[model samples]
Target: MITQEKYRTTVKELLANGTIKMAIGYRPGSTPDRRRPLFIRTSEEADQLVLDSTCITNLSGYLVTEGLLSDEKQVGIFLRPEGIRSINILAAEYQLNVDQIVIFGFDSTGREVRPLQGRNAGDFSALLTEIKENPPLTSKEPLLERVEKMNAKERFDFWQEEFSRCIKCYACRQACPMCYCRRCIVDSNQPQWINTSSHTLGNFEWNVVRAFHLSGRCVQCGNCDRACPVNIPLRLINQRMAKEVVDGFDHFAGLSPTQEPVLASFKKDDTETFIL
Candidate 1:
């Protein structure tokens, strides 16, 4: 494994040599329990850059948000797969301008560079395909078959019960790499998409709406679940969306940023026969 000191040294060298103005890496927290993203603006702070498992928050969440140091500058995200999908979804949603971001991302194997996850890897689409035939819920054609078995009222009630423990901390949204907006619809005061109170209804409404918005783009990074204070399985919705985006569009975000979004670009042959 790369030593922390060596990692910092690498950042310094990159600062002197690379086109990147800022490198968003991580540093060992004061203790074992904390490791936060280190924003190195100068060569001196390059010594602070570190990377570890505890560097858990999806770094891409900051891309269009705080991630971008400024609009006039270019930024690079140290992505794996999760960040790619989120940024791709953001680009498709017009939340991000793709040209402004650079892909300093590498593969799990540290292979050659390309867009999204890696240039060569598939969406693990084969993995989703293998599971599609035998989904977790039941022996159904689609897991949604089992999911939809519950009526809207039942679905609403179920989410209410599931998110009842929510603290309205926005940890899920904050951790979501794809949840980038100067101001989220939920946070807008003029329209107030959802109430600010941390009541059950408000939580449920926000959760469901956000999940639906991410339906065709989420890459199942599971950062939101990891970030959750109460451990909500928000990835269920993301995994559900990933499966749907693949099944419907044969496209998966994060697999390749160069590829177009399924919703934004469609073919004449795209499916229209509802199995209902």
Candidate 2:
């Protein structure tokens, strides 16, 4: 397990050596057990760096914020395995140059903080490959299973009930790293694609559009799920769409920096069963 002292030493050295202009890591939050994102600008601030199971916010989301990387200078970020994968997806989508980012990778295996070997996201290709080959055990959520067992009409009613509670706060979108659009379709009042209100129909449209937009791009980090205040099962919808993309397009999201987005690329050899 990597201690906080060791983590701070590494960050301090990086900042002092000018390897990175800023270091995005974690610090103790308001609650004792909670951790929040911490930005380190100087070596003196490095002592605040912390790495543990509580450091679970996908820090890669910060990489693409407007004006955050505008300087085009190198920035260091503390990343878990999923955050590394998000970097790959970001690179693949041409959101940022991979070389401009340095990854201080770490993973919490049970209670131990294990440092990952990688300077950049691509360096962890083998680790990602291993994850792909031997996927993690997904404990079945009874609620998801129950929804899956329902008939189409019953499932619709279930989601409608769930979405009805949405306040249209857009917290889910704001938390998602992939929902980086400057102007979401719902926000287009000139020709509103989706209702901006939080009524039942509007909520349904908002959630469906959100899920579809994330179909082939979602990293499955459950950021949206965690961000939703109403406890909507956003992960289940994302998982179902992810499985459909895998079965239909034979593509998985966020595996490599060079891999093209599943929906953006086309080949002549591609099948068109839905084209009639």
- Model 2 lowest lDDT segment of ten: 132-141
Give the Cα lDDT of each candidate: 0.64, 0.85
lDDT of 1 by residue, 1-276 (tens): 354455456556656776567777667777885777777868887766655445545677776666464555656555554555566666666666766665444333232223223211234334334434454342223544555688988876766777898889998888777776667888888878797788988888888888887777776666788789997767776677767777878665644345566666779888879857
lDDT of 2: 0.85
Error of 2 at 221 (Å): 1.0
In angstroms, the error of model 2 at 6 is: 2.6
Residue 266, model 2: lDDT of 72
Tens-digit per-residue lDDT, 135-206, candidate 2: 565433576678889999999899999999999999999998888888898989888888888999999999
Deviating ranges (above 4 Å) for candidate 1: 3-7, 66-72, 91-158, 189-193, 267-269, 273-276
List candidate 2 stretches off by more than 4 Å: 1-3, 139-141
| Residue 233 displacement in candidate 2 (angstroms) | 1.0
Model 1: weakest 10-residue lDDT segment is: 112-121
Query: Who wins the TM-score comparison?
Result: 2
User: Given candidate 2, what's the lDDT at residue 264?
Assistant: 94
